[model samples]
Target: MVQPAPYLLGRFLDPIFAIGVGTLSYIQYERNTHREPGHTLYDLLQKKFFATKEQTQEKK
Candidate 1:
């Protein structure tokens, strides 16, 4: 007797998708969490991740 089997591609993708979305939401939640210092989130990301600091600085 033979048994039915599942496809390999779907199994691989399921965990990848779950972890990807979970990590993204977790980061977003942490980003909004409380802070001990007086600083906006825009500043924090720049210091930590080296992310973009300024989009458009006004002319002097």
Candidate 2:
């Protein structure tokens, strides 16, 4: 008995997914490298979690 053709369209999906993931990674890397040093998550957490009373009051 002859076998039916494999689903060829499914093969194209992996490369498309890879390109999308790679593009996103490059964008994220560029943003991280170009950002100011003080914009890191640790600094952000410190600013949010450890703000002085005057600093907190200023938001009002």
Candidate 3:
């Protein structure tokens, strides 16, 4: 038998939305980290997102 409970449907979908958003943000962070030309992970992910994001960063 089928039920017509809209509230129950929404409650189940809420966690799915949150998980999807979190996964997307995490993937973006990983991409930015790997594509960055910095020598170390620390330097690449910490800097501003400028045009030189793909260019080599000089040592400070």
Per-residue C-alpha lDDT of model 1 across residues 1-60, encoded as one tens digit per residue = 998677555878978888888978766875788544636555667656763445333211
Give per-candidate clash totals. Answer: 0, 0, 0
Alpha-carbon runs more than 4 Å astray in model 1: 1-9, 34-60
Could you give candidate 3's per-residue lDDT for residues 1-60 as a string of tens digits?
A: 999656633887878978888878876786777755565444546665443635544633
Candidate 3, clashing residue pairs?
Answer: none
Reference-based TM-score, model 2: 0.41
**Candidate 2 lDDT, 1-59, residue by residue in tens:** 99976753467886788888897886688587886777765568788999999988998
Error of 1 at 7 (Å): 9.0
Q: Residue 14: error of model 1 in Å?
A: 0.5
TM of each candidate vs. truth = 0.40, 0.41, 0.40
lDDT computed for candidate 2? 0.77
- Model 3 segments more than 4 A misplaced: 1-9, 35-60
> Which should have the higher TM-score, number 1 or number 2?
2
Name the better of 2 and 3 by TM-score.
Answer: 2
